[model samples]
Target: MVTLTPLEAELLEVAGSVPDPELPVLTLRELGVLRAVHVRDADAVEVELTPTYTGCPAVEAMSQDIERALHAHGVRKVTVRTVLTPAWSTDDISAEGRRKLREFGIAPPRTRSASEPVSLTLGPTRTHPSEAPADAPIRCPHCGSADTELLSRFSSTACKALRRCLACREPFDHFKEL
Candidate 1:
């Protein structure tokens, strides 16, 4: 296992606390966007980040926020790098992040069984077979009811879908699992 020095640990903490611009409720760490933090020298720190999507508009803002956060914490120099080889998945989201998303009036991504087939949706126009089917249930985050309908395949962001609860008659966003 790798160990962190005091400065490196503090830098990581500050960098990880930077929140995603689109989803303010979750931090970089919670969203699993902040991948790694390395101390380059006595005054410089390097941060690695993975974007939820290739063209996500909020990634630039997130990078700036990370640099500002590190600087606020006394980091003299900060370098933020975007990494895409491994790709970002909904599975990277932490349990606490999912809970926070629900608390923020967004439905968390549904966990699929190993036997379930993975369906990928690229853009707003594309539809997936594995999406919440008519027969399948979508639990409402506010009402705790399973009576919900999909309003649209896309929500405010590409990572979520619009949904409404029949029980509470409230509209909400559901985080789509990639």
Candidate 2:
């Protein structure tokens, strides 16, 4: 068995500070993207990551963030590997991640109760069958109102959707569940 050197341990610690490019509020760890960190020898570190979404363009930027973070900590050689076997879901997000999203002004997905209704009201005047509480809250992140509207099925960000808060009359992003 190989023990991680001080430098390697330090590198992982530093890497933990890096946040997801698309969701700046969520750290890689919070997002459950930082799967593993292994320091080989004294100068090289290997990182395993699982992308939030396969089509997410932020992947390259995330890779760069990891490398830069390790380099900033004096790790000369850093390799970021993407692992997608099990795939990512709202379930993988840590409690901290969910909290971060709330603080960042975005509602996280919701965890569905066995008796919960599948379809949710998107706005005061609109309804969508696609609405389902998976992990994050179904309420508005801004006004914390249950009276919200799903403006669009997709948002500018791949992982998010456009939503409007009826109470606050403000548009915000909602992290969609896979």
Candidate 3:
């Protein structure tokens, strides 16, 4: 028979309740960041997670949130471990998460087909908004405009970039293909 401690189960539940700081529409579990939950002895809880991006600033805040959540669940000690060996990708983003992103006015990351690198090729030289890599084409969530302009490589959030709709001339956020 399989058994799970009360604390472990509560930890899992709390983790699920935590949402992604950048994209509030998705939970940590939806983002595949909540890798595993386990109880250490009677008073400690350990959580394994991976960040969407290596330099993602939310990691610290996330760890703190996890600790707070576990503590609230009556766990005396909490440990949050970051696993990076198997790096996270947009593919790890859940189907529901993708839908949530679109509904939130942010286009999901473009799909990278089988047996290909996750690289974006804007053009022969400088990359443009309209010209994505050969395998991926970024779609504007606001206007559904493939014809877009890369306003900036970075956006208000690390996971997204600033883009403008050529058709509507409205600035929008494009989830970084990475």
Give the candidate number with the greatest lDDT.
1
Q: After superposition, how far is residue 107 of candidate 3 from its true place, in Å?
A: 1.5
lDDT of 3 by residue, 1-178 (tens): 4476775676798986788776778888887788778888789778988988787789998888888877887889889999996888877777888878888877777766657776555546334644554445566787787777777778888778777777877777777766
User: What is the number of residue pairs that collide in model 1?
Assistant: 0
TM-score for each model:
0.86, 0.79, 0.81
Report the lDDT tens digits of candidate 1 across residue range 31-128.
98888899999899999999999998998999999999888888899899999968888888989999999999999987666567777656554233
Give the worst 10-residue stretch by lDDT in candidate 3: 125-134
The number of residue pairs in model 3 that clash at the backbone is 1
The better candidate by TM-score, 1 or 2, is: 1
State the lDDT of candidate 2 residue by residue for 34-125, as single tens digits.
77788877788899888887866877888899999888878899999888977877667888898889888888876555465556545653
Ranking by lDDT: 1, 2, 3
Candidate models: Cα lDDT each: 0.86, 0.77, 0.77
In candidate 2, which residue pairs clash?
108-136, 109-135, 109-136, 110-134, 110-135, 110-136, 122-148, 122-149, 123-148, 123-149
What lDDT would candidate 2 get against the real structure?
0.77
Q: What TM-score would candidate 3 get against the native?
A: 0.81
